[model samples]
Target: MHMEILPFTIAVPDAIIDDLHTRLTNTRWPEAELVDDWSQGAPLAYVQEVCEYWANGYDWRTRETALNRFDQFTTEIDGLDLHFIHQRSPHANATPLLLSHGWPGSIVEFHKVIEPLTDPTRFGGDAADAFHVVAPSLPGYGFSAKPTETGWGIDRIAGAFATLMSRLGYDKYVAQGGDWGAGITTALGALDPTHCQAIHVTLAMGARPKLDKELTPEMHHALERLQFYRDWDSGYSKQQATRPQTVGYGLVDSPSAQAAWIIEKFWAWTDNDGHPEDVLDRDEMLDNIMLYWINGNGASSARLYWESFGKGTRHVVTIPSGFAVFPKEISPPIREWVADSYTDIVRWQRYDKGGHFAAFEVPEVFVAEIRSMFRRYRPGF
Candidate 1:
């Protein structure tokens, strides 16, 4: 397929900004019942402060230009226009690596990782370790075209990305992802195991179960953690999987609603414990929101959860995989359980800090781990 490069700048019409501003100015906030805590939700004062800034203070032009600084393009992959940033390393023979992002996330997650991954030498590493990063917005998320069909699951997307690599003239490349990204990356490695050298992911989420033998202390603890996640943290997934469009309507229409939907998860999932600013400032967080809003992907992003669930694709990923388990990810799998499906468990790291959005929450840790693990497996280009 002939690829169509994205315009240098995405045109955000004045009316849309005006609409956002008007909604912010005239928001009919919900009633508070003598609540001083966050149990009710994000504080009205705080939301107003953020909305006020997003309306009047935040500068989209600056972000827009910054976004365009990296090369962006869109290509048709499996009937969907897949959007991606193909940032080539200056090193002539940099190994190709595909990085996929998860829901409530965009390619914005890689902003800090780009320089480190593309030029490890600058950050005290050999030039041989640099990667030509190919970060793609999943179909129905961010700049990628919304999935018009219902079955755009992880396996389909993995196959699509396999074709995407081929489209980019990359016969072989490495793959990495976290959260939903991990699912897609696993699928990529499974679909085209020959083309993909190896796969790296953030915890396999409930992708492991071993009853054949006794569990080790660490594995037992990890299983307990997984149980906690499934019991307490799966409400959002259930809602998204069951009724994406219904939830999306509210998010797509109300910017505040969208912000709350995505922001709360980032806060809870990241090692932030409600204080999101610890890992990323409000501006940086809102910039990610802008990527979703500008691309009109709130609904489409939710569609991914629905798509994957219906197809039952995520449960079967046959790939040589590595997982970086962060403390805050919902469903974490232990090494033994992960080894049930993935034979090649070359490297595994457990991070005390960091969460679902590892690339953004802890770029230094994530990049270091990526470089450390892939170096062992990735052959010179």
Candidate 2:
């Protein structure tokens, strides 16, 4: 089969923007949450305010222009049309790097670090540290083609990404991701070790360690946090995994539903005192929400969980791997625990700040981590 890599641009018609305004203006809002905190969900007032700003103040053209500043392209891989942003470095010998985003995140998450990673000298770093960056929107997310069948899980997604890298003429590359991106990256390391030189992941999903002895304070805390997530924080995952179509209706039809559904995760997973905006910009968060809204991927994106959540893709990764431990990550597995699954762990660093969305929350730190990890595995560091 022949695959064509076509240059792509983002140009939403005026009719779509006008329709969005009508929907936001005429939204039928619900009553405020009973509690003052966000324990229940996104506060009614908060959602209303954000939606109002989205309708009137947010400018998709500005976001579209900034996105188009980078070279974007689409290619068919494994019967799915994949969308990716490819930025080549000025340095001829720059290493190729494939960056992947997870659920509720789009290529928008990597916008902050793309230039710095691709042109390190401009960012006050050595030119040798530069990388030819390729960040792809996952299947059923953003501009990537939505899967119509039932087999588009993480394993298949990993295979598609490897095909994408090959299609782009990269024989070897490093992969980095967090959230669902982390899972797919790990899968890539396992499935395509010959081409995937190394991997850096913010979220390390390994087997649950079985300790014969007592647990340490840190281990206990990690377990408690994981349990809390399964109990309190995993409601959306369960809903999405079991009945995506049922929930996707609300998300696709009602922009407010989509915004609240995604914004709630940002608030829950980010390292923020009270609100998601404390660490993330309001417009940036809205831009991510708009990716889902405009693409009408509310249901398709959620179906990823349904496809592969418990299909047992969490196998051990043997390639040289680096794990960045963020302080406020939704699931912060201990280094000792992760070492069991990632046998060839080369680097492990714990940060005092940041959370699930490290690239978005701390681009400087994220870039530093990526460079430091690959430097260990890259030839002649």
Candidate 3:
């Protein structure tokens, strides 16, 4: 299929911003959570505080300009206009690298790491470690056109990305992701081993606990976290997977509702002591939230859960793969759990810090991990 890749720019009109302000000012807030902590949900006071700043102090223009610094474009792939940041390295032979983001995250999550990955010499890194980064906003998220039809699940999304890489003239590339991105990247590695050489993911989506295995302390802790997710942390997923449209009404209509829904996850998932702000500043978090708000992606993005949950396509990845085990991940997988699925595991590193939003929370460490893993596979290495 002939595809036309067009240059894209993000420009939210004044009217939309004004509408957002009006909504923020008029939000019908519920009473504060009865509990002192976020066990119930995003606190009323915190949501109000974030919404107030989002209206008054936050500058979308500045953030938009900063985002546009990276080369961006849109292309018709699988009947959708996919938006992506394609930052090429100054080095002549830098490897093409595809970065994927998951739910509650936009391309905003990679803003900090893009520069270092694309131009490593400038950031006090070896020229050999540079990458030509291609980070796409998934269908139904950010500026990318949402799917009006069903069946835009993980397998199809991975195929679309492979088409995207080919459209960009990249015959060989490496992939990295966490969360849904991890699942898609894994699929990419399995689907197109000819072009997609290797994959590095913080989350191994194909992994499952071995019920009969003797449990180590780490395994015990991981199972406990998994149970915790099933009991507490996964309510958002359940709701989105079942009734995305029902929730999208509130998310699209009220900026406060949208911010609270996403912000609470940041606090819960990141390696922060008390609040998400301990790791990521309000502006950084707000910038991510704005991508969802400006695009009115609440329902559209959430529908990805509905379309892919329970029913997913995860082919065993035979390509060389690497895994970064972040300590505070929702439930870090053991190599053995995924060994049957992700064969040829090349690099596995467990970090002392970082969490689900690895690139956003620890860009330096994330960059280092990518470099360390892919150095061997670089062309002519």
Candidate 4:
């Protein structure tokens, strides 16, 4: 029972918040290169407006208080400190589900789903489907102290999560994820075929078609789009996986740069249509950015690629899996391609909406999908 939580009463210092604003106010912006479209990535007008709001109006303490409203705690697992928010349902038999997030995301991703999933009565859903939610900031992200050791790859993180479940005394549980969260959930499916039971993923990079095999029409289209994207859309990942330190310099230095980098993804991937304001409220989005900034995990968050992909790669797969393919992620995988890797088919849904940050962009959609997937395993009469 090794549990410790930072006293929720703790408040962020005014100076730190002021410093963030000061840096944002003085951002040394590059000369705007006019592009015919947003093809250059992160439009100057949009970034300037966002950075201005972040500097003048964004509130960190309010966001921190909102985050601290949950019962956040830490426990030692496998020689590392794991930070997670543990919200138990009054339903004694409520199923346990672990949700993980990816880079540029934190526990903030699930903030919208918490109330609906915890107290269904408040949200017009059935109490029978309530979950004892365990959302963890991946090692080296958010409240979890950056790992001092290496080898904490996705598989290792999956194993650590299994320990977290067992430590919480959950004998059987379902897993859910988006982005790197999806990858970790897949890793969990692979590592705990006996106990993890099932998985739900948003960023199922494993959706790749079988190698050395001809691509189907859908998959061929997906492959072509992916190739085109790699040509233009993968600089961040390549840099993160190869030289995180250099990339870290920009994010670690300026709050505006960090906001621009992260919010651009929201604009690019969401239904924003060149205006993130259309899809996300500025403060709600900045709360997420604050989680990274206040925790000083921006660099370490980027280093996940360095730590995992840097050593090598894992193309291996195992166990039953489900995919919640959103419109804005990488190319959706046809089931035929999925079957080549994960032999067990549980469920797959191609959503009409949602992008990379599935939980935040569309909580109701994700919650409904989770309930649908878990019913296959939690068939309690």
Which one is best on lDDT? 3
lDDT of 1 at 49: 75
Q: Give the per-residue lDDT digits (tens) of candidate 3, residues 1-381.
A: 549999998889999999989988888889989999999998889889889999999998999999999899999998999999999999988989999999999999999999999899999999999899999999999999999899999999999999999999999999999999998999999999999999999987457898796898778877887889899999999999999999999999888989999999999899999899999999999999999999899999999899998898657999999999887899987888899899899998998898899999999999999999999878653
- Residues 1-381, model 2: lDDT tens digits: 659999999888888889889999999999899999998999999999999999989888998898889999999988889999999999767888999899889999998999999999999998878899999999999989899788999999999999989888888899999999999999999999999999989886555755767888767766777878888899999999999999999999999999999999999999999899998988899889888988799999999989987884667889999989887888776777877678998888988899999999999999999989887555332
Count of backbone clashes, every candidate in sequence: 0, 0, 0, 0
Off by over 4 Å in 1: 1-8, 33-40, 211-217, 314-319, 379-381
Model 2 lDDT vs. the true structure?
A: 0.89
Q: Estimate, for each residue in 183-218, the C-alpha lDDT of model 1 and write its tens digit.
A: 888777777888898889985764657768987866
Q: Candidate 1 lDDT (Cα, whole model)?
A: 0.79
- Higher-TM-score candidate among 1 and 2? 2
Candidate 4 lDDT tens digits, 5-35? 4423326688878888888888888877588
**Which has the higher TM-score value, candidate number 1 or candidate number 3?**
3
TM-score of 2: 0.97
Name the better of 3 and 4 by TM-score: 3
Question: What are the lDDT figures for the candidates, one per model?
Answer: 0.79, 0.89, 0.92, 0.77
Displacement of the residue 250 alpha carbon in candidate 2, Å: 0.2
| Model 4 alpha-carbon drift over 4 Å, by segment | 1-10, 210-217, 310-318, 379-381
